[model samples]
Target: MKALLLVVLAALPVSAKLVSREQRLDLVRRARLRQAVDPSTMDLLNGPQGDGSFKVGEAVSCKYEEKDPLHPLGGHSPKFPCWTKSGERLKVKYKGEANPEVYGEVAGSRLLWALGFYSERMYSVKIVCENCPADPWTSTKESPRAVRTFEPATVQRRLKGTEVSEVEGEGWKFSELDHVNPAKGGATQAEADALRLLAVFMNHGDNTANQQALTCLEGDPDCKAPVMYVTDIGGVFGGKGYFTSYRHWTKKKSLWKDAGNCVADYKTTDEKSNDPEISEAGRKLLADLLGKLSEKQVRDLFLGARFDDLSKRQPPFIWPDGKSRPLTVDDWVKAFLEKRAQVASARCPR
Candidate 1:
């Protein structure tokens, strides 16, 4: 019976789509207020470890793949691009770091779901073994484009602005998804605002096209409006120096006044501004969703990232303390909860 079921499932069409920025914007434009964001876009988030179990698979085998020179996914960390298989299948980057990238992937996806935005379904898995198959899929590289990078001078100019919200250095530039394809593709004001809010929440500095996707319908590449997914989400909870800043955004005063105006400099500077990105309803929804997380859920988020007893294991990055030792799980959770409280306070009804 199990074999029969497996065969039946295999026969069924696989409608998985990698949603892109352009496609997401189009959906937002057509959607009603707070209705632009689709929950089903990241169906994988509802998997076995959505609560934050750091197990990608048991007895995993990683097949090494080629790295793209033009559009590299792993910035500084040595990227061992490989095909991962345990129960679920994924093309993963085996980046064994002092702080693994899986933590960021888990955190970003979790928050995106809580905040009610389309996100990628990612997991932090342990690779027990490696078996590099001769043929492995790698990301294709496009022709070189003179993409702008934020210089030090630009950061200074941005900091001088009236609004406190600002993206750090080069690589943190806002995605040109809308600008490049305004007529056919582009986000609604609300969707754009939500993106900015998400960036602030995750301390997301990487706004490049690679970080996002516009997946097509089931087996249909022609379906451009299928779904959207934020691909490069593991670059959060860090600094704002690069597109994937390792900075964290825990302080309330450091962020925008509200989720609606996260992109401070661009809000007033850009003439193409439209409606607010995140609506009151949206904020309340996010607050409610985040508020509903149980203690287990919260703990699981960090635990899945392998955050636990400091004595037993140290954290990845050391920001607010010793340059050598990593932060404690307790401290990390506390800071996260503090930020969550701030989010609820500002957005939720008093």
Candidate 2:
């Protein structure tokens, strides 16, 4: 079907219509933030259409692909390409030293989605290793690369002048178009403000374009405007942890506790600024979304990343000082709730 669409589009003359960067970004922001007021639509998108939330008792299976790339994060934990019994393919990683990283990624994705931000579907599925190939750990593996999240036609349209370049310094073997820095181009004021607020809220320090992808509705290349999603979100929710050098995550209420009218690190321009119109709406939307979740649902969001066999408290966390305590599901949920309150209070005052 996609091939046929491409063929049909190819026969037509190139779209002489030029879409300005601002227009494209505005379209994207609307599509993303629009989900807030539409519950029925949210359910539909969050359902099987988009990456739905993981369900309890879902059958899961795993098999190691020696050719699959290993994420640097999996150094302590192992990762494998897995499929739910329903045939949803996912990249599964075991939790060991990378426990917080996996949890943060899953939490961030869920929270952002709950708040109506476009995010890739991610969930926890326990891999039945019995069905996997022999000596999975011993098999040869390659380093991870950025997965192509956009359709071919959309990529061509959105990135006309941007050059695809190899990331120097990093030992990256793959190439992808640069699309992360919204300030460089292709970002609306609303999106810029929303993204910055989310970053501070989640302590998402990594705002590099590489961590994001401009995807479309139902993977359609010809969709009017491609929406942005954080396809790679493993680097989130690290507050004061010594090992959490990638993103800042804190259980304490600090980043946005007093977020008044401005976001740090984001510049104000005629085109983009800490606009109250966007930020105020975003705060209400996020707070309302967080209110809809139950403690159990929040707990499930965290456990969704860990192996199924582990108990709710099975993977007890140890701090850098060697003093260890189990990170309970309730405790995690409480932290989120506290943050949600702070966010609501920080919005443009009523």
Candidate 1, residues 97-183, lDDT tens digits: the string is 333354555566656654455554455455532444322222233323221111000000000001000121111124432332324
Best by lDDT: 2
Q: Looking at model 1, report the run of 10 residues with the lowest lDDT sum.
A: 151-160
- The lDDT of each candidate is 0.41, 0.42
Native-to-model Cα distance after best TM-score fit, residue 113 in candidate 1, in Å = 3.9
Over 204-241, each residue of candidate 2 has an lDDT whose tens digit, in order, gives: 54445545544345434455444555555555555322
Off by over 4 Å in 1: 1-57, 63-76, 83-90, 98-100, 114-116, 131-195, 219-225, 242-247, 251-253, 257-278, 308-326, 347-350
